[model samples]
Target: MKDRFVANQNAHLEMVLQQMTERLLQATSRLMARQGRPPQCNYEKKQNVWSLATSRRHCVE
Candidate 1:
């Protein structure tokens, strides 16, 4: 019947919309991460010596 066909079409449309929403969320997350600030790299300078630290303890000294 025509009603059944219409219902099927609506179900398909709903599925497509759900998929698009998921993709949009994933893309937004990726874009936000890329545009966000880079991780801090601690560097210390002591008497002509330059040291780079990537961990917490190493950065302390």
Candidate 2:
């Protein structure tokens, strides 16, 4: 049970980090757009970004 908890916590941390990275990337992209520069992500254009990596935009994906 202790090991399982540790594993679960690690997974949650990784997921959180991934979500933050995606948000930063998108925000950086948008900032660059306003500065007359292009984004480096090259993510496929979607009607909305509610799905940066997973299909949810909540703080944790």
| lDDT (C-alpha, whole model) for all candidates | 0.51, 0.67
Residue 22, candidate 2: alpha-carbon lDDT: 67
- Candidate 2 residue runs with Cα over 4 Å from true position: 44-61
Q: Look at candidate 1 and tell me the lDDT of residue 52.
A: 24
Cα lDDT of model 2 by residue, 9-43, tens digit: 97798678767866777788899999998876664
The residue-by-residue lDDT of candidate 1 on 1-61, one tens digit each, is 9998986896687568656755665566566669894423311122113212223434463
lDDT of 1: 0.51
Clashing pairs in 1: none
Instruction: Give the number of the best model, judged by TM-score.
Output: 2
- How far is 16's C-alpha from truth in model 2 (Å)? 0.6
Cα lDDT, model 1, residue 34 = 90
Every model's Cα RMSD, please? 21.2, 6.7
